[model samples]
Target: MSEKTNQPLRICMISYRSNPHSGGQGVYIRNLAKALCELGHEVDVLAGPPDPLLEGAARLIPVETLDLYNPEALFRTPRLDELKDPVNLMEWIGTSTMGYPEPFTFGFRAVRHLKDQLHKYDIIHDNQSLSYGIEKLSRKIPTVATIHHPMTVDRRLAVRSVRAPWKKFKHLRWYSFIGMQKRVSRKLPKIITVSEFSKKDIAREYAIDPSRFSVVPNGISTELFHPMPAIPREPGRLIVTNSADMPLKGLYHLLEALHRVSLTHSVRLTVIGKAKEKGGIEKLIKKLNIAHLIDFTGRIDHHQFVREYAKASIAVVPSLYEGFGLPVGEAMATATPVISTTGGALPEVAGDAALLVPPGNSNALAKAICSLLDDPEKRKQLGAAGYNRVHEHFTWKNAAEKTVETYREVIRDYR
Candidate 1:
């Protein structure tokens, strides 16, 4: 970092999609933007559909696209007028062909939107939208990217989960954007990732040298996720935040564990996200006859999320892989005991504060859940430990400081 550059920076942050209040990525945008603003930096977030809803001095620069994947009208064909823009045509074509081109289209749109405004910012931070247009931005200005985790991990998991050759092909097609991301990632001068595990994995998968990476662990919002001691934890009430059908989330394994545990002891699961009607998850729940044992809370705001965590006996993160396990950190921030699988960087987030189980092992998950449920004292201890751990190690203040350091490094290297 340049010692002379002590003044706050004008930072432009970009993300192809920020899912508002849900998902780790949305939480990431909202918290990171607010924290950076609080740190005295002039931060402007350029984000795509559903709005990042960033708070504080940070500003939102809406980068609108076709928004083809919006749930309300998912994959609807663009009108002829809308398709006049080459980018919109490309987006519709990609979606119609079973490929996800949001990041690519978003980058194109963002670059066009930012071209006239580029001189107003000191640095640009690209949030995993490793598109060709993003690479173009790097040549004109100092640019950095944050690859939360290797998309290869998600692609591989999705492909492996399907047995049908055609289904496998579709999974490959949907994740074709990974190729563009990999190529563009190599062109960036700096890459910020969420965990040491993801840093190494992304470095290898994207074929970039590890030296180009900076590992900045994400911060959990203590205000929204903090413990409500007034709320009584319900025994056997487990909570998980995930789209039930996503293979990478490992919700199937969690459901299996829930079924097994319910055979001996009465237990219920509260999934924070909804399942598609008659989707894979709904079918599986019917097949396992555990539909009665689980409930979905659909979309929820921060207050509801905190209340859900507080009321649960334990929070669970069943992801088969994560760059950084946000669910675990959130639960810890809420002083909720957590049971997570040792997949990817989950163990790193949980540390010694939560019970660990092997990924894809329903039997192991069941055993761990049973043990925790049977011992309230152990649950209470783990909850407190997790709370302390998050406060000490995973606050946004620490993350923003490190992030600014990375920003300064990029600026200096560009200079």
Candidate 2:
């Protein structure tokens, strides 16, 4: 059933840290690869620490590195046998100095892996580990990268959120990976991103031509995120699935809006992610005296998360910026009315289905929540509209088709 490509492409997807439980990129690789394989294309995923949660037939090629950020064991004790390589010692030193050497190291490992199997693959698709060694791989094979968004946005926001000057400086130092990404991005022939907003932002941030980028919006897992008709809806409860402690997620702003909403309305906020102990969100909830009104569901499974979405009267996405807001689409897939902010690519995802408000404006968020809370008809309408929008515009099958096309294009051009 493989469509007639110029040639059969053995495509490999690369990810630095592909933990489905933790972040969006891992979910993207898993879903996209599975979709591609269903279309009769051969797909393999090359990944680093926290291995991917992939489906059938798609091979997961894990390249083990020192998972330095392991919560239980911060610094992994190196085996004397493993330490025989001087390069490993160098890597350890490089990482110890607070430099993010993993991406570069992973790229080196990937290049070595590909050296023996270079003839097998027609193209190499990178999942945002834009390292110097990655640029080297492009020299050998046609390479395409998917930049979800510029990391500079996260860097800038993290720096801004840090109250202490030293902490801000350390944040800036830690985000030095941007320098490598910017340099390597300009040389790449084709780049994929989830939104037009991301395309423009990446162009400016990396000083690359906007035309070089392709906007392929991410698809929601409609099957998994669909409405559970058996689960009864919870009235006056709002749901939002954002990383609570991250300033970039705008959880503090959502909390502020929730505080205002609690003054007159008896509503509760169920945040899907946990607020870190002594983190900003925990501090703010105490400050606003809305600790009783907010509920934190720390990293629940997909079934439970979707059930929560189905039960809630409405969902809110109060992110400061999103390259592609998955929660909005997921909420919509469950037929939940959404109130999302027009931050970064959020509007692109929310469209006319959800009520859009300006980012960082708690008053506007509170007003939107109040309006949805007041009118059942409006909520129902929005929910239906959102579901329709997601069904029509975003689908995993479509994303896989376009990605397959891109692979063929890159391979043909490589020849």
Candidate 3:
């Protein structure tokens, strides 16, 4: 039943690209939109290539792009006519030059797409697409931006991960858009982020005022992630969501911990993601000789995810940093005990429901895993605590309510 408001809001939620299974941005868009709709608001998600799935009364408005980085045809050259459009040409040129130009180009494309309907939306919420074109929209309408975290962190971590001079240069070039983002974000009236840790870090890195940010945490999908009381837990089983070779994910450290755990216990790991072709993760598995102990579920639906969590003895999130740790919330929501690091907003999310270890510490992770494996009663206790914590604190309805509060603030403060 819709919680009809005195005044229903029309919101334009924009994302440059929102592939549902790709990452957090997609999950965020899908869940947040539904929650807003339930609160008696109309949400039109304006997104680019690789479409986003929507539930409830929220709608999707797709703006076509050259999509040079489409996984099906990554970095493919556009035809002469296709590149005739200035936006397409710029995006193509930027990609060819070892830079990511989608956010910048998507801004212009979004501008064109929304020009006819500018007055339809009460507020424009940018999902991290802080481009100059987005800045222009902020000037015309009440606009708010959600910077999931600082991309500057990712850039630094990525550049440091590569050894070769050229690889470092390429990584640096890819993140050059950060300069544009910082400028655009500063002009916006309000910003929403997932955690206070993100608010401080992004302000420090992007040079934006901390006062502009409202730390509204992301919510877990309890309907999808709740405990499966019917499925029996598998002994010595661990599950982790993977981000391939990204050093910031700290999967490498987790692999080391897994190897260490296997030496002392009968352990098996289930990865809810794929390892890229010849990627660092694929090579590392062979290096540790732990392939036989790990199962990679390339892509899974919500049902499979719940089943996997239901059977897992423990879930681990070993990210070196996270804007907000969704994995921690997901595990907890599923009534699975969690082991997370003191990385970024992880501890904020974990609270006291799970074990906490130092980021990038294999020995600590192994120790935590071993302790949980040997103590079933402790695991059960933590699992129930996590489950209780998620329901009591993190829910889409709450996140949506807080987000709407921010929306109203931006609307009232609009110049």
TM-score of 2: 0.95
lDDT of each: 0.90, 0.85, 0.91
Residue-by-residue lDDT tens digits, candidate 3, 1-415: 1133358899999999887765778889999999999998999999987878788899999898998878789888789999889999999889999999999999999899988898888889999989998899988999999999999999999999899999999999999999999999988889999999999999999898899999999999998888999999999999998757898899999999999999999999999978989999999999999999999998888799789999999999999999999999999999999999999999889999999999989999999999999999999999999999999999999999999999988888874
- Each candidate structure's TM-score, on Cα atoms with residue i matched to residue i, is 0.98, 0.95, 0.97
Tens digits of per-residue lDDT for model 1, 336-398: 999999999999899999999999999999999999999999999999999999999998878
Could you arrange the candidates by TM-score from highest to lowest? 1, 3, 2
Candidate number achieving the greatest lDDT relative to the actual structure = 3
What's the CA RMSD for each of the models? 1.3, 2.1, 2.3
Q: Residue 294 lDDT in model 1?
A: 87
Q: Worst 10-residue stretch by lDDT in candidate 1?
A: 1-10
Model 1 alpha-carbon drift over 4 Å, by segment: 1-3
The clash number for model 2 is 0
For model 1 the local lDDT of residue 201 reads 97
Candidate 2 Cα deviation (angstroms), residue 308: 1.0
